[model samples]
Target chain A: MRSEELIGELTAGLRPVRRMASPARQAGLWLGLAALAVGLAVLANGLRHDLQERMLMPQEVGQWLASVLAGVLAAVAAAMLARPDRSWRWVLLPVPALIGWFGSLGWGCLADLARLGPMAGQIGTSWGCLRFILAMGVPLAAVLFWLLRHAGPVRPMPVLLLGGLASAALCSAGLSLFHHLDAAVMVLLWHGGAMLLLVLAGALLGRPLVMRRQA
Target chain B: MSRTEGEWEAWMAAAQAGDAAAYDRLLRAALPLLRAVARRRIVNPAEAEDAVQDALLTIHTLRHSYEPARPIRPWMVAICERRAIDRLRRQGRRGGRETPIDDFGETLAAPGANKGEERVAAAELRAAVAELSEPQRTALRLAKLEDLPLTEASARSGMSVGALKVATHRAMKVLRRRLGVEE
Candidate 1:
């Protein structure tokens, strides 16, 4: 063996690690399944209610919901690619499916917005401008993430960039739904702020494992 | 050859129960890996050899400090680092000022099988780390590399907790960007 390998073997010594008990892990499995069920129920009810309220405008509903769901899916994929947890892989299943579901709904919404005639032209002007900026910024950040090709498991810059991208997408999606008079400022401060919050939540969740990790 | 985990655990139990022969066997088993660590950190072959020896001796002296209930790796690591640091200090004082040998614990495995893949990973990480301003680099080296706590690093580096936090954050950001973690 190489000298370094030999040394590594020696230092490994007779130190056998103590693995965690299996039953405790099983309880966590059940809990996660329960959570996933809850999420599905909430989504189902919300969708049913929204559909009933919006008459039969299929195209507009599909557009608005599809884009939001797609953005979520993109974020989830980005996260999984960044960190793949075997136990968490199950969470990935519904995410993409939900995105597909939402995308279809969102398509209708986008169509509805597009049809809001020249009489309500300012709505188009503002939403269109904001949407364009958001669309450009979000995808640009995602592309930058791909380009960066970060060599490690977790790094600050990539995470921040991912956060920025997610934030832009989230802000745009929120503004698309609720056009407060100051839509731009609302998206920038409130929506952008919430996205940053989510990013911090993700980092916080991953910290213990990442922090203890050897470089 | 791979030993079963049961056999390894049994050996550990025996060593923990004060079986002298089992303890000796354990130390000897780890010799190769310990030497590898020393070789990687120490520049001179002779110094590396001596450093490993001293580290082994410390391991023997502090064998009881290894809690039988816990994994033995960290205990061994702690001893190895302490000895390595002493050697670095002795040598450093001779040359005016010295760098700590505890700057790195283990070299990371590279991802690809390209001939220079491992060397390249090391080079890239080293370059990224080196690119940090002295304070950021120092904080990173202390906290992540040496695995020291923020408070201990603060005492050693004389940077306040807030300043150290900023340095570590910036350093982590640079490393992340370089590695493409955000992407």
Candidate 2:
């Protein structure tokens, strides 16, 4: 049929639709879910033994702040990228936050190395931490993916990448709350590794799962 | 149809709220722009219209995603372009054989030819086409006889455009040999 005819037919029976949640609201929802997932993980594995002391320490506090900031920035980026027509500028939103996250992690790692004299023994010891982040990330990624599905991203790769990054960052922050390992090297290696894996997985799966099928 | 950005956003906002009338207006206003976008990509009018239709359907499905505060043109353009590319790809797969029927025009127009001779030539041409393989014959029928563009022919025949082109080329070569016609 002619496009004109089809347009008429399609719009003729149109019903009222509720507006989709704004990007900020969607991000907030994902963050809320992340908190719940983290709580469950903490219940399952217990919080760090020095939780109160670490929470008071500047190094730990800085790492958490940077991770949380990265998560928020990444969530915003994901929301914007979910739209096919979003400005390219939106992709840059997470850059500063990501840099800060890495910087804070590096600083924390340096402090630990100075105080504890090398993390050689702890480097690969916490495979469980990797598993924990992935376990937590799966549900977070799922919720973010659900939100993005409604957004109908045209370029699913980038959108999914951002969503995965945001999910990983949020999951990493949650891990910090539950896992007591002061070894910043472990956090960098395992938690960071999980985040990278999620982004890569998202990139690979975006076209097949996230994009709308060709008409 | 040349609405200001605010007007377009307002219409979209209303549509998002289930204002069917506003949605209708927005779509009507957007049609020409959508058509123009599709036409830029698809040479065939029918195919271009089909792309526009596909994009409009997509827009309808994704209407809620349009933030009322944002400009609507980019969203519409993106959908239109994506649909147009899909139509083009589909058409390319069908392989358009737009060979003109004019080659046989002169023979049919020969002055000395009587009805009996014309019937003989027609039968010979039909027989030649019939002798070709199924794929070749279908390609010839859709691309040459029916004068369908490649994409539409591909859609009808379930063949990739490249395969249809090869089929049509081979069919023509066979016909030329049988008819003793120059390329």
Per-structure clash totals for the candidates: 40, 6
Candidate 1 residue-pair clash tally: 40
TM-score of chain A considered alone, across all candidate predictions:
0.34, 0.85
Classified by CAPRI criteria, candidate 1 counts as incorrect
Query: Which candidate wins on TM-score?
Result: 2
- lDDT (Cα, tens digit) per residue for candidate 1, span B122-169: 899998888899999998988888989899999999999899999999
Enumerate the candidates' DockQ scores in order: 0.01, 0.32
User: Model 2: runs farther than 4 Å from truth?
Assistant: A107-122, A205-215, B1-4, B17-21, B39-50, B84-183
Candidate 2 TM-score for chain A:
0.85
Expressed as tens digits, the lDDT of each residue in B50-136 for candidate 2 is 888888888987887888877799889987887798788877777675533433555556666647778889999988988899999
TM-score of candidate 1 versus the correct structure, residues matched by position = 0.28
**After superposition, candidate 1 runs with Cα above 4 Å error:** A1-19, A22-48, A51-196, A201-215, B1-28, B41-183
Task: Give the Cα error of residue A100 in candidate 2, in Å.
Answer: 1.5
